[model samples]
Target: MSAEIFDICVIGGGINGCGIARDAVGRGYSVCLAEMNDLASGTSSWSTKLIHGGLRYLEHYEFRLVREALRERELLWANAPHIIRPLRFVLPHHAGLRPAWMLRLGLFLYDHLGGRKLLPPARSLDLHQDPAGKPLKADYVRAFEYSDCWVDDARLVVLNARDAADRGAAIHTRTAVTAARRDGDCWRITLQEKDTGRESEIAARLLVNAGGPWADRVLSLSDQEGGEGEEGHRIRLVQGSHIVVPRLFAHDRCYIFQNTDGRIVFAIPYEGDFTLIGTTDRDYEGDPGDAAITPEETAYLCAAVNDYFRTPVTADQIVWSYAGVRPLYDDGASAAQEATRDYVLRRDGGDGGTPALVNIFGGKLTTYRRLGEAVLDHVEDVLGARGPAWTRRAALPGGDFPVTGFDDLVARLSADHPYLVPTHARRLARLYGTAAWDLLEGGEAALGQHFGADLYAAELRHLVAREWAATGEDVLWRRTKLGLRLSEAEQNAVADAVAELRAALPNRP
Candidate 1:
């Protein structure tokens, strides 16, 4: 085992930790981040994939959270135009449910709550005549349309981690922080790779517990006692599950449906061939890593959307389903849905003599960047080693192109490689942006062997080399959504290909 030292050691590679690592490394901090699993193998990748102010949060009276998330939405969209693009959602007004007046007011606040730039404002819609309403029931005569952005959630996390690595942060994926303890003024931590079962030790001036769903479990690793005795760790494990069905509508717009049960569901166009419906907020017990969608939850989601759409959806038709455990801050909320979406950073051991530990509890994808900024604020106060904050204006990895330049980028990509079809070129540009050229610079001939779908050997090589993608699941699921498109045999081929490439590599992270 190799022994080394660092200024900051972050334990988790989700969006929040990666975001923090990116900010820290850019600010010239010697940093190391370890993830027990693949990056975004938790709640970060399993989001509804919207970068928006939670409209429902308005009912919770969380004004501050909504505003911050709304503001961060634009910043995130601006920072990553390739994977994050503006999406418009249509909320059809049901006669008996929340009155039209309430919906209008909510839309008003949602629009003005955050500064308006880039995205268009919310507007009233005549569902009777509007194209977005074509798929809804006949009785829903009016609707409201608002703007949010769609993110390839898993890719977003990977991009942040990639940028952090680019800035010189040692990122250890599939490595678990087995134990941690305070050694005088530093934190001595033990890490074990999941596959190899090899243990290594390192010391860091600061430790960060960014375990999303397992914050409490992570805290136990350090065996540190806190003042909130009996209260225990503040994380409320809430499992949100989503089901994807065959394309429900042909429109580009998304639908946000309100249920009589005071809950809401989003039916969004997914992956060009399916409709994604989601998210029941039920209090979950047991290991979050084992969280999966239950039959009842699937029925609930299907029924939630069935109340609005003209074509009814059934459970058996689901192409894919995913459930993620939300590590919400338990603020004595009456229900799991009512729990706070905002993040809380509880700092310990930073007063004077002891080393500092920052434990992050509860955050949403929309506000991850700001959450990271806040984490750095705590780090600066404790470590006294500092640099200026600079993530807001930075374009992550290959996202340097203009926000509206997607079509142009696609055109350029196809032109660069004339052999690439329209579908292949567009997928490449969206996933890799200008970075696609790195793999395709040799044109179709240099793209190596085709592994079916839009995936090629060269692209797989790039993921392995730069993105820390090791297993087939890493490439098919997180790094790209090709799992949905590739067949069982093709998936196995991808796994075999990745294994071949990974084994050939001399250095293993």
Candidate 2:
């Protein structure tokens, strides 16, 4: 293949990198994005999976960050309705904790801060008389219900990469940029294939360091490559973790439980058969790829839920757990929870001495799209403008239909292929949106293999062919949440089948 020069080369296949690539490529810039591992194998996939403005952030008075996130909530939903949907949260009033008046005031500001058009406004609930209160303690007599959005976090990252790829950008997964040097006005980039130990060279007019947890590592590479100073800002690694257990409540509304230590934990309905609870903020050191939930963290999460729920959570009940380290811009906060969630963009070589390197820092999944727009604004400023910002209204792949039309799409999909079971059809429609037909082309009979829980070979092939899935974890956990549903032996069977399938495949991405 010819080493065609690119206008932009992004290092990272997480949400930020893919979002930027999609935006840049849509604007007519030649782009290439390389991920050291599977897309969103790190921070992006490990989020709380909510697209709402940070309700707890109101205590820190981060109005600007909250406003931007709130604005993107509905906008992102409209663009990717298949993977994004509205969710309601229940915040019960505690007699000795945050006063009811203060809670009301915060919700009021949250409602008006961002343009609240698509979602319903917040309302007070008589927990004693409401079904949402059935799972809560008797002491929690009253609560407030508010709106937010849920996202399939990993799928969001993959969809962004897919959109970028469809828009003419090359997405290189399981590939790492080993070296980068400034070659006059261009960046001489060296990429290593993780599997075969092969290396290749490419060139780009600009370089973007969107490596979330590895931002500093990639910036160090550029410094060694071009003799540039370590101009990238410092970042603090904060570990956040969650636990999933058998369903604790039948209600769809989630609970935002307040702890005495001034931290909040959420209990949300997940995967139809389980409850998702989590997130403890603690400073972390060492590699982010090895992040895992500790016994203490698991205990803390269980206790957090035990504090508010009638159905007490215990460590033995945890069916699955995950953890990820966030690379937050270091503002020297005393506590990890106190750290800022807002993003920072630092540009090097802006004075025309070498190729520009843009360093991304500290962002939430909720603001990824807006973050992309801001990144390209800097790129457009350094390089020549290619086209105006266009991602705000453009839907991601499989997300062309309206958010409310999801059930209708499911019905349509089942009708076209009568062989599909109702559960299978719903899963496909929810995951692929308008593109479900492409993944389920030949339906049940032609679906290469059946790996339990509606995870057929047809969908697996589509994930590998289109979404860059590699391992069983990538297929079971990220591509789909079947990891929690599949048994150990069943999981191994799927892994062996996928490995055999991978051997027959041409390339990783």
Candidate 3:
């Protein structure tokens, strides 16, 4: 059968791919995005969960990258204030690790470099007297408290894909692009569903390989070999891991500690109950799809945390762990940590030229919007002028709430939904933002039964109906982190409910 042709076909559903699909579709392009696993199932979810100007990147002189990221940080925060909140990070000054004056200088540049409006500027701290100081050892009396934003990474990807779909982009989850070939001036593509082995073929005038860590594989599978000039540029995979442990500090502010090896580790507040600590840089050689935290990486993270915190953190304190492989562009850097996080775009079509495949290399979560716009610019170069860039003001799906006045919004929701528990109300506000009202439309009258721990029928039904939640894990883990709070039997009960609910739906996917 001849496949339906699209203006753009995007492979991989990570932040970059989803962002591109969302951008392209909004600009009046017929688009389709395919992902082998769930959205953000890859490196997107395993991020340090920070939307910040990489303070460490200053040492490497990546000023352009840092400035762009810092600017986008404000944009993202303004767009999704509920899920992405301003987080103050305390950086303890160690004598040998980093000179206090040098750190201060960096913070000074960071404050003035990019237009920082809503968030507070960096301030000096006295560890001996400040409450943020209590967690640190006596030697580090001086610290710098700076600002960054925390993101629900997985939700970010899903929201982008959702927005793309709403703008008429076809999204195929659990679907992998097995082959792509340039046929005449159009490209032929094949998609295989992972679960059912169902295969579908399609034609696209333009292809985008935003395949994160497996970009090279996509290039190879498509029989598109890198040749002389720009098309030959490649991506280097680097692995990073994070560990979640019992809360180590009392304050909401996160801590950035410098290690002996000149690397930095973050101890951020996680899920209202845990401290998220992370990340070692190592060249990854294994499959990106199968990356997991090793015992050595776990120990390294624990040791890095134990070095600065007053309280000791052993492996026993860890409750959850995750790892991700970053698809960075190799710039001939000697060390893994020194590799650039900036993105590079490879374009291959135009005029009387062949259809293009733009492969994105190395980008941070904070910079996806800018990356998306840059991608559209590349697409325009090949396809001629299509549409003006408008994603700057456009909210992703449900992020339409007024940015500066969230307190009033929350209070209004509380007043409106008096039956909702405070925690559940806050959870709804956090998860759905302004769309919480839409999710609770049927209200207490329609809520049939409570499964356990804030898992109600109304919410589950909303997840299934609106959020494209396919399985219990998708509902519990990705849509909301309720899995950590739910018991095994309660999880099974939700699973049973999902199955029953799915069986009854006539239009179930």
Per-prediction TM-score? 0.98, 0.97, 0.96
Query: Which one wins by lDDT: 1 or 3?
Result: 1
lDDT of 2: 0.90
lDDT of 2 by residue, 1-509 (tens): 12699999999999999999999999999999999999999999998999989998999999999999999999999999999999999999978899999999999999999998989999999988999988888988999999999999999999999999988999999999998888898889999989888999999989999999898889777764422447538788999999999999888889998888889999999988999997999999998999999999999999988988897889888888999999898888999999999999988774564788888999999999999999998898878899999998999999999768888988999899888899888888878898899987776677977788778888878887788888898999998999987888889988887777788887644
Top TM-score prediction, candidate number: 1
Model 3 lDDT, residue 473, Cα = 84
Give lDDT tens digits, candidate 3, residues 1-509.
23579988999899999999999998888899989887888999889989999999998999999999889888998888778889999999888877988999999989988899988999999999999989877777889999989999988988898889888899888888888998888889998988689888999889998889988888887756753465466777899999988788888999998999989999999988898998889899978989999999998998887888787899998888889999999888999999999999887664586888887888989999999999898787777667789889887766787776667777878899999888888888888888899888877887777889887988888777666676788788788888878898998888888767766663433
Poorest 10 consecutive residues of model 2 by lDDT? 223-232
Off by over 4 Å in 3: 1-3, 227-231, 500-509
The lDDT per prediction is 0.90, 0.90, 0.86
Candidate 2 residues lying further than 4 Å off, grouped into runs, are 224-232, 507-509
Clashes of 2: 0
Q: Global lDDT for candidate 1?
A: 0.90
